[model samples]
Target: MSEKLAKFFKLNERKTDVRTEVMAGITTFMTVSYILVVNPSILSEAGMDRGAVFTATILASVIAILLMGLYANMPFVLAPGMGLNAFFTYSVVLKMGKSWQFALTAVFLEGLIFILLSFFKVREAIFSSIPLSLKKSVSVGIGMFIALVGLTSANLIVQGDGVILALGDIYSKEAIVFFFAFLVMGILSTRNVKGSLLIGIVASTVLALILGVTKLPETGTIFSLPPSLKPIAFKLETHNIFTWEMLMVVFTFLFVDIFDTVGTLTGVAAKADMLDEKGDLPGVSKALMADAIGTTCGALLGTSTVTTFVESASGVAEGGRTGLTSLTSGALFLISLFFFPLFSIVPPAATSAALVIVGVFMMSPILDVDLNDYSEAIPSFITIIMMPFGYSIAEGICFGMISYVILKLAGGKKKDVSPLMIVLAIVFLIKLLAPKIFG
Candidate 1:
């Protein structure tokens, strides 16, 4: 028993601190709890009900992240991801006029492709193909983009006609909740407090309850499970996978999720000191595989695509090592499934509190990029600035990649481009030009 435990936790040779492990678990829990609700909100917009989506979120987080810890031996947590939710709700369902069922089908297919790609040695090849300058840009851009999302979701920013983005009303419900959340997050982050995000969320939830903002519309005569929450006891629809529309949507889902997972892994690696000297990450392929499994499971369970969250870096920074942290985190998520009353009460304001603080933590990687070098500066600048402005993660990433390719090609350094980079560039360009070409 001791030998098996040692191998599972990698604790045989050296001493392990129970306190540090517990702290890491708390960090992972804090980071993922918000997404439990947020995933449903985004997917609900695409016609999914609340309870079923929550169930899927729990199942995916448990299965995928635990697998990551057990097999991959990485301290990253996987869950229903944020950016991909936007893509699924916005691009797939709304923009493409596809049904929610069709969208899930696409997400499932994308996961299969990602799994295949991971096995075929495409993961490292794709990463290597990306331009160095673009990679730097992606790093910085995603950081800034995540921060912008934090701010906007917190209602710190709002849309304005004259301005692309403007300050939100401080007195509004969302804005007020966001303001106090940000305040708490600032204090926790500045003090280098462990579980600072968790603190902010708890504080915000307390304040919201005191202000009489805790009540939400009940599901039925009394709150009960939504039908959609039922695990795949029945399939929704059978779409022709070979159809051009399905194929395009699947490809889009693949493109967005792969890059999103890559960017997240990169960010988390940086936070956890998991990066090699060459700035490349080990275990990324394993992480990608874990993410693919999560997405696949999420689809089968009737939820949106699942991916890695940048916020897991918080747990990593809190002294997490080995897969134990992810396993612990996943266990917490699965256990929470029975506590619907408690889970449903987590106000968006409180969740926003955690997200805003996490955004600030993620922004640390921006400092590593040398702003003085134009090669690095342009792509970084584009990514950092465009994320908030474009209001889409893929747009920001695509722009950064495009700029990096153009700059490198112009510099007569075409030979420096990797085949994967070239493939990404070509695919990205074609994606952008498709409307014009097909129209």
Candidate 2:
């Protein structure tokens, strides 16, 4: 059985064994398992049933990660994206007054478009066309964004009137617990401890429970049947398919998902030493298709855009180089269906520690950015700062792309900007000015 399984995943060729892959998979799952709770909590703000979204999140994750493993033969996991879910709830549904059904429709349409783009190789073209400086900037911007999410979730940071942001009450129990968790995670990581992030999360949760910040789950049973999907699944409202607002929303989803998947794949592949001499991942097209199909399936299952997770880096860092690692994580996601009661007991502060530490891991690529060049530095600065401050990946990328093109053109280096980038800049500008232009 071991030999057959290894042969199926090409384990030996990738210089990995079943035990290593399984351990890597467990590490990956532990780091990303926070999504099991966070995705539903965020999406429920849009009036979706929390239990239903929870079931959908896990189901979508299981299918997507399995496809990524079996078909793409890559060590990556997929789940409903972080920033995209917030955009679905806040920007599209709450701010624009669209129905949650309409938001689901937009996600569906974006996924369909992504599938077509992937099939025709258009997605790869756009990814390859991105400027090197912006690519590095996108990585750093996402790191900042993830860190900001961690800080905000743990209440270590708070809004302020005199200033845009201020520190939270360091003396508060929650804040103290979070800081301690962060310190423990950082030290363990620096000491090269495997599963250090997961250990930190467990330690934080135990502390929270002892401090009375969180309570144990009341569900006496450890296993139960998964919730039915009838409430939210396949509930997309297709009537407003062609409206300008819907188009813009779809574009935003597509733009963010595309870049996020590309960035994560590149980063994790580099960590796993899977990149070729040209700095390209082999079989990336298959991976992108897995992401596209995952998003489409996720919308149908009543969730947000599904993409490759940056948390896959934890697995790669643990010596995961073959699809077996992803397959293991996928299977664990399926098993989690009966254990939601137990997982629900985990405190948000605990998961925030993992996110903050992952943010630290993701910052390494920023060192590669050519900060000496003003043309590169200015746009990169915008990208990194805007992601956390603006609280939107799409907004950060939009500003970064627009600024990069303008800066290059102003510096008499027009050839540095791609035509696709110019068109994207115009689209972003229209998105910004649309209300005034059309109102």
Candidate 3:
């Protein structure tokens, strides 16, 4: 079994052993396990059953993560993405006044489109067309973006009354927990501790209980049967699938998901040193197919798009170098399906600190960007700034790509830009102008 396992995952080639991979997988699972709580809470606001969404979240993640491991043989984990879920709930259901079923139909169609794109190698070509600086910038940009998410989650940052953003009460218990947890992560990770991020998260949760930042679970509330998916599963409202709004919605879903998956896959692979000499992830086709399959399966099972999670970086930092890491995380998610409340009891501040630390891990690629080259620097800067500020990885990539092609073309460096890049820039151009044009 060990020989088959090592041979299947190329553990020896990757310089990772079974025990190291398993521990790294545990570390990865602990870091992203918060999504089991977070995704349901957000989607339930759209009138989906909280219990149902919870079940959907874990089940979808398990399916997707398994595909990533078995098919792609990459350590990337998949889940209903954060920003995309927000879009499903707030932007589509609340703001656009679409029914939740309508949103599901849009997601369903988008996933189908993605499958087609992946099968044809279109997605792979797009992935290869991105400039190296922009690819590195995606990592740095996601670092900042996820750090901002962490700060807000920990109440260390808040929406300002008159300004755009402001600091939270540093004296507050939540802030204190974040500081302590972050320090634990820093020191432990610096000391090369196994599962440093996981340990820090555990430490933060204990402190949260001690300081009353969050409460403990009610007694005897750990394990339970998963809620039925009847309320939300297979509930796509196809009546609007051919409408103008549907077209826009589906297009939006497809566009954002494509780039978001691209950005995430690129960033995490770069962080893991999994990229080849030409700055491309090996087996990217299989990776893209796994993501596409996850999205489609998630929509059918009642959830948002399931794409690669950036939190996978936490495991890579802990020395996870093969599909075994993703497989192990997937197995934990399956077990959690029966232990829902137990995982939910983990305080948001606990996971928030890990995200902030993961952000620091992702920031290393920034040094690779050539600041002296204005064309490269500006787009890279835009990509990095736009992710957190725009609150969308896809939006950041859109702006970065469009600006890169335009700047390169204008500077008589047209040769630097590829034909595919020009095509992508035009698509991004349409995206920027669509709101005004359609409105």
For each candidate in turn, the TM-score is: 0.86, 0.88, 0.96
Q: What ranges in model 3 sit over 4 Å off? A: none
Judged by lDDT relative to the true structure, which candidate is superior, 1 or 2? 2
Residue lDDT tens for model 2, 252-364: 89878887787677656755768665556778888899899999999999999998987787677677898889989998888889887776676767767677777777677
Residue 250's lDDT within candidate 3 is 87
Report residue 29 deviation for candidate 1 (angstroms): 3.3
Which residue runs does candidate 2 get wrong by more than 4 Å? 1-20, 94-98, 239-248, 266-277, 317-319, 433-439
Worst 10 residues of 2 by lDDT: 270-279
Query: Is candidate 2 or 3 superior in lDDT?
Result: 3
- Residue 373 displacement in candidate 2 (angstroms): 2.9
Q: Among these predicted structures, which one has the highest lDDT? A: 3
lDDT of 3 by residue, 292-346 (tens): 9899989999999998988888888788889999999999999998887677667
Model 1 ranges with Cα > 4 A deviation: 1-18, 41-49, 86-98, 131-136, 172-177, 215-236, 317-321, 414-416
The lowest-lDDT stretch of 10 consecutive residues in candidate 1 is 219-228
